[model samples]
Target: MQLNVERGAPATGKTIRLIQTARASGQDEHQIITGNAYKPADLELLVRHRISRGAKVICIDECSEQHIECLQRLGGRLPDELTIHAVVSY
Candidate 1:
């Protein structure tokens, strides 16, 4: 599992975007996941979706601490391919 941290993940207003709508390739994939980081259930579900669907990257829009914690807990499940792009705003 490789980890990539970046700023400015896609989101809808104050809420995070919570679904994988597209596939990225070759140096273009920073990693993305969909879900409201503030919501624990959403974070868990979104992360699980990535695992179940075999997504290579996890991108959370408006990522909160819960999102990061969720990743730390379940990230190992992803095994070989895993990328995380966490967005934070100050």
Candidate 2:
């Protein structure tokens, strides 16, 4: 599992690069999510569900501090086999 946290300014093509990288990695299952689409708790639940469904990679675009905090809360709960990519823009 590889967790890639790409943090930088907006309009930097972070999301684009993330998707390209995930596709190039040949992962069978990858999901892309927008930060504002869900609250912290909801995001955690969604991630857990995806993990249970054998998702290999999960990408979060425009990721916020709340998103990071939520994932941090999951800590030991997150699957070791799943990779998370968070593209956060300031």
Candidate 3:
């Protein structure tokens, strides 16, 4: 599932709803969770979701390529059996 948050609105509840809907529809099997740095805590929750679903983790950050690269590298190092993914904001 792909979620495109428009204008960075603080729709925390909406974001959670997106997650819930994705899970219910079996869209959480594989994902690339992306979010900006301003929502670090929320991004963490996305990571947890991917981990729980046994899906690969890919985080996208528009603020800092360095941070995104670092996160991708870290994701590459995880055990092959574990598919939890996370992208840390810059």
The candidate scoring highest on lDDT is 2
Error of 2 at 76 (Å): 1.4
Candidate 1 pairs with clashing backbones: 18-34, 18-35, 32-58, 32-59, 33-59
The worst-scoring run of ten residues by lDDT in candidate 3 lies at: 1-10
Candidate with better TM-score, 1 vs 2: 2
Clashes of each: 5, 0, 1
Summarize candidate 3's per-residue lDDT along 1-90 as a digit string, tens digits.
232222233533444555554466455623434455435445545555655666543333232344334444545545455433222222
Better of 1 and 2 by lDDT: 2
Q: For residues 1-90, could you state the per-residue lDDT of candidate 1 as single tens digits?
A: 654434443443322322332233332234444335248666776667766877666656565666666667766666666766565543
lDDT of 3: 0.42
Where model 1 places Cα greater than 4 Å from the true spot, the runs are 7-38
Give me candidate 2's TM-score against the actual structure. 0.83
In model 3, which regions exceed 4 Å deviation? 1-31, 63-90
For 7-53, candidate 2 gives per-residue lDDT tens digits of: 89888888789878667656422457777788988888888887888
The positional error of residue 28 in candidate 3, measured at the CA in angstroms, is 12
